[model samples]
Target: MTTCNYAAPPFDHPQADVILRSADRVEFRVFKLFLSLASPFFETLFGLPQAPDGATDQETKDGLAVIVMSEDSKTLDSFFRFCYPSTLADDPSLENLTDGLSLLAAARKYSLDLIEKKVCQALANPKVLEMEPIRYFAIARNARLAHETITAARYTLRQPLIPAQFSEIELITASELLVLLTYHKNCSIAVQPLTKNLKWLTDHYGGCDACIWLFGPYYKGSCGCGQVADNRFSPWGIHPVTWWATYMQEISELLMDRPSGDTVRTAADRTIQQVRSMGCSVCSSTVKENMTEFSNLLALKVDEAVSMIQLEMDF
Candidate 1:
């Protein structure tokens, strides 16, 4: 074998100079210092690819070509700085409420804090509620703030005062009712007002139809009927006993008949069966553990404080 003295190209070669220059330009455009540092090695390893000879300015700016381009901090910052407010101001598509809602969703999804704030501000405007789905989505997503949103929506809905033929009450949904109930349970004097209202309503109207629907006829009949009365009918012509018996009988037969007993027993049995089927062992265990840990922590804190006070010699 003949020994050949072939030297690798120098850094100052014309090709190497072109590569370094291209890399520098790329780093400048991208405005990423890390990319700038690594550019020399990268350019040496891979030669700069040729751009299309006659590509238009718009084509390059639009970045629609097959070549892979990196979006560095500078480009992104510039793009957003101009594009965001411009899009908000001049975009005809965003004039549609649905588009605004979509933008809100996108802002939320991407964790774009400023964008989300802007979207929320837009939504706060009265004009935004013209989109029903957006209004519903906002209320549904932010359940904690739903009361405020509902109040705002009600105000908006009433403005220009166009009355519809059919009127629907903007009452809380069943889930929201449960949330309100749980919220109330933590407060003192909760049961007093509820009990008082229940009694007042019962005395005045002879029981609520909605309550009857929820708890069944047994609750309705048993609540107020005199001992000697075999049947109970409200002043509103609702036969509590008959309705309860019929509804219970229908349901019982459909899902395995239960023996005639106290409503509480029947309800308890149904609940137990449902809970058992749910396989909530983890939840039960976690709840038990949490309760134990909380009690222990409280006891430990109390003991620690007592010990500290005793050590202070003010006993």
Candidate 2:
């Protein structure tokens, strides 16, 4: 039960009736009535009768109540700054996402759900999750921000995060962490079959005689049927077949490197670029259409696999 005669922060209103002191002894002289109006939680707290002998309070001077908070002075100032717009000349400084999240936690601790939601919105903007997705995943999951949780989880999937690297595992629920791991496993398994249908482009869509001129006659001579090549024994050009082979290999590599819908699309795009380099009208046009279809199918499969984890998104 120690108390200090500390001066209030610079923004403290002169007519404030309550003093909030952080663990480090910094003081914020904020108004009780304004806080109560903004949050029913504070109103209910203020409605309670004073503790006998002011047991929970550090000290009350000049008829103003002094309530000591467990948060550090920085967090208290940040939290109060958002609650009191008059104290700030600029928009609430929410550049530090972790601090914004911590302020939300403090708000929720005291049932300031209104402010809690505002903080959630603030955290949703900017590069918070991108900065540290695994860490953001842990925080969002704990805060029960379902959309943010899934967004961070998606980013986490792309990272090389190890369980040992996460310092805040205790903040993440076992079930939630299991769900994320399950999502990674399912996506890996789902993308295993993500190979382009080589038969469809090569076999089914065998090139016509004129097609070989554009593709370069990869085969030596025309068959008795007046066709330059059939995909089974002869391809009009090496590029289409080579492209599919390279694409399949890329798919396998991507499956290992986090084969999300977006990553697979990039792989498909690269494959199509290589296919175009062959300058074969038949190969370029056919493969472009087929690759688009394949990418869509693979993306759908990945999304379905993610759905199995049931970590539904909020937006």
* Highest TM-score against the true fold, candidate: 2
Return the TM-score for each candidate structure.
0.24, 0.62
Q: Which candidate is the best by lDDT?
A: 2
- Residue range 1-315, candidate 2, lDDT tens digits: 665545445446687788877878876777777678767767897788877773665468666787778888777777776676564423366766668766877898877766776676667664766566777777777777777777778776555424446665778767777777776766566555444333333443465443342233332342111232334323433443445555666676776657567666778888788777766555665657777876776666655555555453332
**Local distance difference test values of all predictions, in order:** 0.32, 0.63
The alpha-carbon RMSD values of the candidates against the true structure, listed in the order shown, are 23.3, 7.7
Q: Between which residue pairs do clashes occur in model 1?
A: none
Per-residue CA lDDT of model 1 for 127-222, tens digit only, reads 544434224333433433443343333332212222222111233354543432232222212222321122333553355553343222244343
Clash pairs, model 2 backbone: none
